[model samples]
Target: MEKFTLESQFQITGIGSASGLVYKENSLFIISDNGSFLYQFDIPYNKLTRIPLVKNAQENIPKKDKYDFESIALKGNKLHIFGSGSTAKREKEITYNLETAATEEKDLSKLYKKIKQTATLSDEDLNIEGAIFFNEKWHLFQRGNGANSKNGIAILNDNFDEKGTIEFILIELPKIKHIETSFTDAILVENKIYFLATAEDTTSTYADGEILGSIIGRIDTQTMKIDFTQKITDINKFEGLTLYNKTQDKMEFFLCEDKDSEVLETTIFKLTLDIKHN
Candidate 1:
């Protein structure tokens, strides 16, 4: 197993509860789980631009009305944002066209129901926190933070049609202090899948609890098996990740933390992992 080390950490201000992250075109695209805006952080200028996800709402949406966007994935010229699906209000998906700045919304109730039935997941156990489109398939990670503690992945067709066939597979993540870790976010680089997970001391999918830190892991796409898992020494609960850069001997990823607070500040950390040689 290759080892990952923390090289540096950056504290990004004026953003709250960042749940999904993507880096492209020298800018960081972020979405908060509690807000109705998509934040764009310009890397060179260190400026933050708030793009409204909805036209009528200029301010952050209330907690009760928030869609709980938990995962964001960039596919070609489109950006896909997904809700956590832990509640009825969370069963929605927003797709934004990067090229045209056009947006489309869809109800995921039918799809979530099929996922629950196929995975045999109870209502409380169906929370998706991470997603990525790789190899023409959409891989969605179920957080498994509820009482059932069922962490798994759902593979769907690229179109993501609710009537299409959905495949579900369970994953047993490493435990931290006897508490099982659940998926938070994931990014795909080359043919490998890099994921973020955290051990939270709670069984409710809709509630927050003591975070026991986070872990980073890699999975081989061919065999669909985890190659290595490493626990981050930091106390931050990193929920979002994106590849910042890569080299022959190392890979750098940008990770963002959500402290489960309403404060308008977030921390972004630079994680470096050394590629092992035979």
Candidate 2:
């Protein structure tokens, strides 16, 4: 496959490091995991504005600790934000209205307890990082940074109410020494699941410290198998991705790399995919 870089790199300003992006017409909504701010940017002009979704997100967390926002998805007119804090055994999903901007937190504390009671998750398995809606279901992917476990992906029903009732389909990675791999983000494109991930030689917990490389893969939803795996190099720690339909044959993929250090900028890159051949 050939890769051609686009000219435009949308650099999001005022936001620390964005983990999620949802596009609406000419505007792009981004979620900052560190700052807990929701940013809206005008596409063409690249003008940016911010709206705080959870004020004092770091301090307000159960134990006054920080967590990554991870991933976001839009269903109808509502937006869902997923993340985990110090007290959470699993990530919590928060919903917000697009028009009204009103927010509601789904009390997943009970759900987390229920899942733990049934042995669905352990304290270490709570690092959920990617979420996407597909085939009338929401698929959540969790990253594994500890030993004796590979990264996993779980599918959930819509509304996220079937936490304990739902059976998660898990994908386990092969054990590789000194290499840390985790799924970052995902998008459904033309009946195929395109996922973004990172595999680093060093055991870095922070997103910005991960080694720069391409960890793109495709999953066959019908067979539920990872059909292809390829590496894209030079790109930094990619956190969020989405497929944008420009036309029937003219589709593009937008991805965000969370570079928190130095410039502390989130970079957006546009890429064209060859779906017909894949």
Candidate 3:
């Protein structure tokens, strides 16, 4: 077993940091909910670059409200971005290449329609916000709608197609009565999975609150079951996570926080792990 501690923090100038992926050795590509801008930032050096939003993505979106990008996954050289549309009818998966800057879009609704026309039960109601690749498959987690919403994880294939069907793995909250908690992002380190989540208090609205609550869960790749779960109640809303492989015996976890503060700003924390085997 090992313990984790925060090593470093930095501010990011973007809002609704829905999804983020490591594009290069020390660079990250980030997307936000309020704008169609893609930002690239270099760690340590702290350089920032911005790219334009997709050309016609706004047309397919159904509402004038902001779309929260929930998850991000990488396969080979392509980056896959997913977000909860304003309506269920507008869910989308966008694929882009960092090397050549090529892009493509897949309308999830159309895929669901095709699967439904064939008489199959698709979990179309899932509002996916977190995604990670493990054991040659993709796992997606969604933030449910309303108080009674069920939080679950879905398994997808390499082509981003549903493996068979989405499995609803209900996340039981300890202090909170509602399952309005959103699993926003996840990362795979070695054979374990770590995820980030936020809980909405009863008196707090979606946008305003103490924003205090984060959970890290470990999944056994062999059985696809969560083996260990730990909750950290002091940290604010975390949007993305990445595992950095440094030395053979050293492992570090980076967490991106989504906050509107000026001084603390948007931050990335480096967690140094101290592992001890019994």
Candidate 4:
């Protein structure tokens, strides 16, 4: 177990809201929810480069704010970025080439519609936010919409074939100050899983409500075991996370916050995990 702490926090300017995070080479590639540019940053995050994606085509990402990109998963050089399957059910996955910037769009509507029907999820609670690639399959996190407040994970193959699913047993999670959080993001390291549970003040599936901060936890997928959990009260609407440095005594991560256009803009910060928790 590790005692996590927020430290050395900083902000990245210009990217309105960060939705997904991934790393290639020494650059960190972050996706924005509001635009066509993929944000790239160096280790220190002092330098940033905006890489553009397809936006002009109507079939591509919508020009409106309706298309919400939530989380990203990496498989070799092919970066799989998924849209949060909100009420629209127009789920889209864009597989992009890291080196050449080539792109291919995947229509995940049918697959997601099937998942919703199988899970008995209503339109409001059908938002798929967090994602990762492990165990030769892609694991996607589903946020609990409305008062249901039950989160879930979906395991899919490369072609988005539904393999199996696991809904979070709330009693297994930490007794947080805000237990109403939706699973936002996650990362895997050496068989250890760290994830974000964010509590926002919204009442629907497609709106951004007041942020109630977030909690980071380490859990096992097999047994639904939580080794330890930390409630971070600082970062607002935290959406994306990535491992920046891992050491024998410490594991450092870069956390990006998706503050809405109202209060504070989008930003990235550093978080430290002291790998010793009682």
Q: Each candidate's lDDT (Cα)? A: 0.87, 0.64, 0.58, 0.71
Pairs that collide, model 3: 70-129
Cα RMSD to the true fold for all candidates: 1.6, 3.6, 4.8, 3.4
Q: Report the C-alpha displacement of residue 115, candidate 3, in angstroms.
A: 10
Best by TM-score: 1
Per-residue lDDT for 155-250 in model 4, tens only? 666667544443333323443355476788888888877888787777677666767678888777676577777788644777888888888888
RMSD score of candidate 3 (Å): 4.8
Candidate 1 error regions (>4 Å): 7-9, 58-60
Ranking by lDDT: 1, 4, 2, 3
- TM for every model, in the order presented, reads 0.95, 0.82, 0.77, 0.86
Worst 10 residues of 4 by lDDT: 57-66
2 versus 4: better lDDT goes to: 4
lDDT of 3 by residue, 1-278 (tens): 34656655566654344345443578777765444556677876888766655774331132345454556677788877776542453367777787898877787765434333333223443456677777676776655433435555666566655435544455543333343455667777667766766765533123335555665556666666666555554556666777765465556667666653323135566665554420
Q: Give per-residue CA lDDT, model 1, range 37-120, as digits (tens).
A: 788898888889887777673335677677899999999898899998888889988888888888898888889999999999
User: Which has the greatest lDDT?
Assistant: 1
Worst 10 residues of 3 by lDDT: 56-65
Global Cα lDDT for candidate 1: 0.87
88 in model 3: Cα distance from truth in Å? 3.8
Over 4 Å off in model 3, which ranges? Answer: 14-23, 56-63, 111-125, 161-182, 202-210, 233-235, 246-250, 260-265
